[model samples]
Target: MSIGISMLFTFIVAFIGAKIGQKLHFPAPFMIGSMLAVMLFSVLTDTAYFPKEAKIIAQIVAGIFIGQKLTRSDVIHLKYVIKPTLLLLVILTLNTFIMGLAFSYFFHWNVLTGLLATTPGGLMDTTLIAADFDSEIHIVAIMQLVRSVGVLLLFPTWINLFTAEKAQEEPAEENVESTRKKQPLNKKHFLIVLFVGASGGLIGYFLGFPAGTLSLSLMFSALFKLRTNISAFPIQIRQFAQILAGSMVGSSFTREVAASLKTFFIPALLLIVVYLLISYLYAWINKRKDWLDFTSALFASCPAGATDIALISADYGVNMNSVAMIQIARLIHAVGIMPLLYQFVSFFL
Candidate 1:
């Protein structure tokens, strides 16, 4: 297909997918919906889909958003969760390694693909890195998708009962007024983000870091925020980035991957088991440490996005603030630290 036609088609399909996802209130619906829609389109047609700069921008946007999540309140909360968070980090890494071994031995998958699939990071982010590393996109995408959706659906329910009961026992805290007034956005803020994001991404790209563009964008944006009050780019940018990244990732699934998926069923199941085990262990630690309630900890520790966890917490009476903070710490460790750790470990493999 022509470039113009491909872009048009991608947007149309992504629009339809995103609409459905939004209606259902799925996590990162734009990304998930567009990815599934684009995957189906690629499988049914001969069109070659490409979004050359979209993925890079998406990474930058994601990194910036994540960096913004690290605030003073969040940092203070992390002090309480430092022990549990560190333990969870070790557990998550170990779990990924074990799952990687299982996939390599049982499914005849390469070590690279297996490890990437099991890495407890954001679905879109992991898949983007998988593509850069030349892994099987379909398997990695599906595995991450399933694990994410599973955590989204299953963990919240298990913790809901406890959270609901706890809510009944404790009186709701009074809403406190903010000391600082809200400020309006200005052009200066926009210019600052643009410059920082671009420069940081370039440094990361040239540095040859794994997911370097994202890492550098996150670091630079975060450090800038430390000195100033620059807010993240608008939510619309993150959504558009998701749509672009999802579409690209979905289109990457080839016929060979589809054919081999049947052989992957058992490995996928094993991956789910690994996720469940880690979630339960982390939840137990959260409860025992008194850092969070059972429901809050469960959702916080489950390998899903903080946004998804926060949404579920809002609906199910889990402590949204606590879950968000803990989940952010886990995400920073998983995405910022684990990729390099995986690369170092892969060197031995």
Candidate 2:
């Protein structure tokens, strides 16, 4: 098939899958659904095609989505959770190295690929970075996807199991609604966000930094938001970006990737174990130190998507602000620093 025809087919499949996922209320539904749908089509037809330029565009969109989360108030709130944030980063960094090394040694994968797969970064961010490293991008995407979905599904249930008594006593806190009003969209501001993301992505692409496009775009978007207090991108835009990213990732599937899927079982299990252990450790420490309550600490330390964790924390009636600040710090570090660190380690290996 021609490139245009292939892309169109892939995108249609992705859109259908995204809608199905949304209807089912799946976590990170658009990307995951689209990826699965495209993977099935690609594996069956072997005609899936996602251009490099389109992938770059997707990265820019994902970066901007994350960047819009940052605001001046979030910066001021950073100090409140500085210690927990630092602790979470430290634990996660250590876990990344230890688990990454284990995966490489046991599975005979490249160290960089192992590191990329093991890092508890956002699924899209990690997968994009995997491309820059020439690592097993498919494996990284699968592992990160498993991590994200696992956390979203399991963490809340585990928290509820442990905190059932407390929840019963504090039933009033359940269903507390958000007071923040949604901002009306402006065309000029939307264009500005895209312009900033594209500009930063271009600069990063030219600078030879690891995953520079996405990282720099995120940094630039966040800075723009902080400076101008204008971060307005339509939900549709975000969904479109996710669909594009999912399609690109899905188009990478082939016979080789499919055959290698079974090897992920042990690694995925290990990833979950490490996440649970570290999250529990953080919660234990916090319980003693009283830096944050047990629920907030667990949620913040869980290493899922930052925004999702923060929103979930609110439903639990934990310190939502602290959880959000800490999770954002984790997200920023994972997006900006983890890829660079993995690259540095790769050089020595």
Best by lDDT: 2
Worst 10 residues of 2 by lDDT: 173-182
TM-score between candidate 2 and the true structure: 0.65
Q: Which portions of model 2 miss their true places by more than 4 Å?
A: 100-184, 276-349
Residue-level lDDT tens digits of model 2 in 1-349: 7989999999999999989987986545677678778888988989988875665676576567667777677567658687878888999999888988889889887888888888887777788879898588877888886677556656766687668776685535422321122445687988988899889978876885445666677778889988898868765766787777678767867555566558776788779878987888999888888777887788889877653454345445566556655776787788788878877777886
What clash count does candidate 2 reach? Answer: 0
lDDT of 2 at 183: 47
Count clashes in each candidate, considering only residues at least 3 apart in sequence or on different chains: 0, 0
- How close to the true structure is residue 248 of candidate 2, measured as C-alpha lDDT? 72
Segments of candidate 1 deviating more than 4 angstroms = 46-48, 76-81, 100-185, 292-349
TM-score of each: 0.66, 0.65
**Alpha-carbon local distance difference test for all models:** 0.66, 0.74
Error of 1 at 322 (Å): 9.8
TM-score, structure 1 vs. true: 0.66
The residue-level lDDT of candidate 1 at 25 comes to 64
